[model samples]
Target chain A: GAGVSQTPSNKVTEKGKYVELRCDPISGHTALYWYRQSLGQGPEFLIYFQGTGAADDSGLPNDRFFAVRPEGSVSTLKIQRTERGDSAVYLCASSASGTGGMSGGYTFGSGTRLTVV
Target chain B: DQQVKQNSPSLSVQEGRISILNCDYTNSMFDYFLWYKKYPAEGPTFLISISSIKDKNEDGRFTVFLNKSAKHLSLHIVPSQPGDSAVYFCAASALRGGSNYKLTFGKGTLLTVNP
Candidate 1:
């Protein structure tokens, strides 16, 4: 792909429901990241993957949130018992390498707007 | 703790004038700084970036200035245009051992270029 792609551009889910958001990173990109942005706030890091393994998951809010990149390309973010506080834009970004300097910068997707009501 | 801070929530600038957005960071380890512009309902787009080794970097009408002593960085847009009106975010990244390099972003400052 020419750029990073996210699925379900917009999602409206009821509170307590389970939802999954997907990301398809750029072709051959070795590093993938997930972030969440609230209104009036900048994007917050959620998790980062170096190849097929998650290099950093410290940013994940809680155990309710989990992400997986099984093949080192497409990734999925799963939320169990979504709450209203979870309503926000979920962004996915990819870089050619794990080192930010080597990749110039990460290419971001349009993001999935998740609305929990 | 907010490692990166953008004190101004909003800024209004006249078209064709200069627009300056400021950012401050608390971490001295941050070696790279980047600026991103975002519109409503869209993800942020990379604007410009500056490495700590350099004091300044310019691209077209945009220039980024960094002061390592104060851990401060600013983005200046010359001849601001209406299309430049958007939320701008300041991001910092540091190599924290191994290959872990995550970006820390500020709250963001909204710039409105009024025509």
Candidate 2:
């Protein structure tokens, strides 16, 4: 992909409904990151993936939120039993890693706006 | 607790003047800092960055200054232009080995440049 791509740019679901947001990172990028941005707040880190394994999951808000990067390429962020408070934009970013110096800066997707009513 | 903080919620600057956006962080472990610009409805775009080793970095009209001692940083836009008007966020991370690095961002400062 020319840039990081996220699906279902806008999603609306009733509270308690499960929703899944998808992200397709740039080709050959090895590091993928997920972030959640609420109204009037900066993007908060949720999880990060290095290859198929999650290197750090400390930022996940709670058990209700989870993400996976099975092939280390396309990833999905799943929210179970969503609440109205979960309404916000989910952002995904990718960067080339491995010598640890991909400082080219992260390429981010437009983001998915999820509204939990 | 917010590791990164942008005190000003909004800023209005006259076009062609200087616009200085400030940010502060409580985490001393954050050695890498970055500034991102976002337009309405668009994800943040990386503007400039400064590593722990350097006190300042410049990229065209964007410059990021890092003061490790104060745990503060600021983005300065000289001769600010209307096109430069947008929401600016400050992010910080340790950048440890890359994979362990996770960016912590501030609430962001909205800069409205008026002509």
Candidate 3:
């Protein structure tokens, strides 16, 4: 893919329901990341993946918020027992290398607007 | 406590003029800084970045200035265009355990470039 792609641009789920947001990173990007943004706030780090392994999961709010990059190319963010406060945009980004921070910036997907009603 | 802060909620500038957005951080470990622009219903796009080693970096109409002493950074856009109107966010990262991929971001400043 020329750019990062996220599916289900918008999602409206009921409280306590489980939802999954998918992120398809640019081809060959070795690093992937997920962030969440609330109204009036910047994107908050959720998790990060270096290849097929999760290098950092410290940012995940709780066990309810989980993400996986099985093949290192595509990733999924799973939210369990969603709450009203979970309504916001979930963003996915990827970089050429795990150390892409020093080289350049990550290319981001449009994101999935998850609305928990 | 918020490590990064963008005090100004919004900024308005005329096209062809200069637009300046400011950001401040309390964390001293931040060694890399970046700026991103985002439109409604879209994800943020990388704009420019500056390393802690450099005080200033310029690319085309965009310039980033970092003041390590004050823990402050600013983005300047010259000859601003209406198309440049969008929310701008300031982000920072610190090298921890040899990997610095995690980014800490500010609240963001909405810049409206009016014609």
What TM-score, computed on C-alpha atoms, does each candidate reach? 0.96, 0.95, 0.97
lDDT leader? 3
Q: How far out, in Å, is residue A24 in model 1?
A: 0.9
Return whichever of 2 and 3 wins on TM-score: 3
Model 1 chain B worst lDDT window (10 residues): B94-103
Measured over the true interface residues after superposition, the C-alpha RMSD of each candidate is 2.1, 2.8, 1.3
**Candidate achieving the largest DockQ:** 3
Q: lDDT score, residue B29, model 3?
A: 86
Residue-level lDDT of model 2, residues A84-105, one tens digit each, is: 9999999999888732222546
Model 1 Cα lDDT, one tens digit per residue, A9-97: 99999999999999999999999999999877889999999999999999999999999999999999999999999999999999888
**Between candidates 1 and 3, the TM-score winner:** 3
Residues B10-76 of candidate 3: C-alpha lDDT, one tens digit per residue: 9999999999999999988889999999999889998999999999999999999999999999999
Tens-digit lDDT string for candidate 2 (B35-82) = 889998888988888888999898888888888889889999998999
- DockQ for the candidates, in order: 0.58, 0.53, 0.72
